[model samples]
Target: MTDPASWPQESASLAEYGEDCVKQWNNVSLRYRMPLRGFFSKRVKDAAEVEDLTQEVFLHLIRRARGGPIEHVEQYVFQVAANTLRDWGRRRRARNQDAHESFDAEMHQPVTDISPERVLLGKEEIKRVNAVLRGLPERTRDVFVLRALEKKKYAEIAVMMGISVRAIEKHMAKALAQLGSVVDKAGEQD
Candidate 1:
């Protein structure tokens, strides 16, 4: 190889291209932020998260624009936003799927046909669950809530909590074992 260091890192006119792209992005950034935020807000209620996602969209566009001059800035921005939304949806679905896979068969029971006795039992069950959850280690409880209640995938939970997926699975298993024992004892009493 002829000198790796001397090889052109980027195009000779890369700075000019980048500068023009930055100008284009600044010109259209404000006009699109509101609409992008609105779109993200519809999917999630958190204002902070919506703002973050809107910023992410712009960042993605900026990266793309730096590669070449965008002939149609508005269209490209919206297209990037749309792609971002699709990616968000895919990740959400995958997380939901991971949560579902971790659940046992009892969790899949249909809830449409509610009986008076069933309602009473459900209330009692909720009380037991809350008590058991309160008794769990802090991380265990958090893992349980995110996986079981929030329906987050183990991988997603890992990323959010800055832990490993195996750790998340361990926490879930511990939580389920504890809860299962409590539920079993309660059933015996009945």
Candidate 2:
């Protein structure tokens, strides 16, 4: 059986070990904290981030120290700092944080105007185009819709319609001429 009187001595030694560890950490912090800040600040932009990274480096050191004594604390601390920075960069990239831009209403304004006047004009234009499409011969309308709306090549359209390439070209020309006339008339009215 263990002696109960020896328990106090063991507890005292454990307390001394704890104190020694604390003192060592305090010395390491005092010696390298500013240097670590400089190391991070040279690579990182934000002051807050530099400080956070510095704290992260110390946290890594503390965790690693628990496992065993570091032979070269300076080298280990720097390596840990570099790894932390790289990890932070990777996470920032994964989140698209680097691509984020601050919102400025004037700078980020919509490219297209969606005002009432512009919307009404756009609706009217669509109506006019639809009216022209409705007036076209069925084959010509089909060719125009296939080429313009469906984005089919002439050869593809010809194959689909079972028409010759020359015939397809003629139909496209006719459709374009009718649409051109409508556009020209609209331009004059405006």
Candidate 3:
């Protein structure tokens, strides 16, 4: 068995470890590269990602060997490979990569129904709504904006406004009644 103390330290360059250490490391890498590729290929679907993961495993092994000699090189390599795969899985999940869809220009084109008449009608409706909202009491308007635009629950809005949930419900009811009347009037005009 070789002495662990003789293994390369962080301070020692790979060249200082002599050609034999380099050759041994190269041999170990070559022996394990194909197996590591197979290991990654079994789990990852993307060919590029599998190759990148296989390379990452060897990088980890190199870093570990630089720290000190591994007692069981084969076992250590596979362990690192397993850990690398697990980390990759965690990253993929965090990024929500599984839910992503590739974009195609034809499929993602902008809607063609935005005619000038529709746009002008939308603007007039927004102005009418804004005028009504402005005429409302401050608290009622605030409750309306918080619930409608911000999508806050009644309890959440109550907590935020330092009011009771019942008060929140009352305010929301009043705001909705006023808005509903405005919508009815607008429909009559149309």
Better of 1 and 3 by lDDT: 3
* Model 3 misplacement above 4 A: 1-19, 109-190
Best-matching candidate per TM-score: 2
lDDT of 3 by residue, 79-187 (tens): 8899999999999999999999989999999898899998998899999899989989999999999999999999999999999999999998998898899899989
Predicted structure with the largest lDDT when compared to the true one: 3
Could you give the C-alpha RMSD of every candidate to the true structure, in order shown? 19.3, 10.9, 9.7
Q: Where does the lowest 10-residue lDDT sum fall in candidate 1?
A: 8-17
Better of 1 and 2 by TM-score: 2
Give all candidates' CA lDDT scores.
Answer: 0.76, 0.81, 0.82
Error of 2 at 68 (Å): 4.2
Candidate 2's residue-wise lDDT over 80-104, tens digit each? 9899999999998999998899799
The digit string of per-residue lDDT tens for model 1 on 1-190 reads 1233432333332232233545445545645678788888888776986887899888887677567755555566667877887887788798884355555777887768789998898899999989999999999999999999999999999999999999999999999999999899989988
* Ranked candidates, highest TM-score first: 2, 3, 1
Clash pairs, model 2 backbone: none
Worst 10 residues of 3 by lDDT: 9-18
TM-score winner between candidates 1 and 3: 3
Candidate 1: count the clashes. 0
